[model samples]
Target: MPSLDTAKAYYEYFNQKNWDGMISLLHPEVRHEPNQGEPRIGLELFKAFMQHMDESYEETLTDMVFFTEPNDERVAVEFVVNGIYKKAEEGLPAAHNQKYVLPAAAFLGFTDGKISRITTYYNLPLWIKLVSE
Candidate 1:
C-alpha cells in the first residue's frame, strides 16, 4: 500500500470525479453512514451512490478544506463540499436544479489500507434550499 497523501491525491481524485478510483480505495465490506438514517453498505451501494452523484451534480469540489486524523487503523476527514447542483438524485425532491454549495464531512475507518467504514455529515436544509431555488 502507498502512503496516502491526504490533501493532494485524495481531493484531486475527488475533484476529478474519479468515482472508480475513489471506490478502489475502499474495502469490500465498506459501509457508509451519512447520518442517523439508513446506512449504505458494500460495493453495490457505493456504486449506487456514485451513480447518483454522476446523475445529480455537474460540478466539482470548490472552496474545499480538509482536516484529517489518521492512525494505523483509520482516517477521519471533515471538509466543506461547495459546488453547484446541476442535477438531482432519486428519493430527493426536485430541488437540485439550482446552484448551491454545501458543507459535508466524511469519517473513514481503515483496515489493511482500505476504508472499511465511513460516516458522512452534511446540512440537509442547506442542500434542500439550494436545490429548491
Candidate 2:
C-alpha cells in the first residue's frame, strides 16, 4: 500500500479500536512519539502505550487529511480528535467521562510498506482545559 493508504489504514484501525490491526502495519522497531513526551521504541512498547491509552480514554479521528512525500516514504495526517476522558492518567487532570475535541496531526515514516515511525502532535493545554472543564 502507498504511504498515505497505510496512514489512513492505521487511523481506521485506531478508530475501530483494533489494536492488532494497527500493530500489524508497524515495523518491529517502530518509534512512537506522543504529543509531549519522549519517543518510545519497539512494537512492544507501542502496544503497551496503546493499552494505556485505551484504558484511559476513548477517541475517534475525524476531518482527516493525509499528505505524502514524493518518494512515498513519509505521510502526514491532520485530523480532529473527539474523545472522552474515561480514566485519570498520571500528571493529568482527573477524568470523569469528560468530552473534548481538538485538532491534531501525525507524521508517519514508512519502510518496506511498514510504518517505522509515528510522531503525533496536539495542543496538550487545550486538551487539558477542555477535559478539566
Q: Score each candidate by Cα lDDT.
A: 0.69, 0.94
Which candidate gets the maximum lDDT versus the true structure? 2
Model 2 RMSD in Å is 0.7
Of the candidates shown, which would achieve the greatest TM-score relative to the real structure? 2
lDDT tens string, model 2, 22-63? 999999999998988799999999999999999999999999
lDDT of 2 at 3: 83
What are the candidates' C-alpha RMSDs?
Answer: 2.7, 0.7
Question: Where does candidate 2 clash, by residue pair?
Answer: none
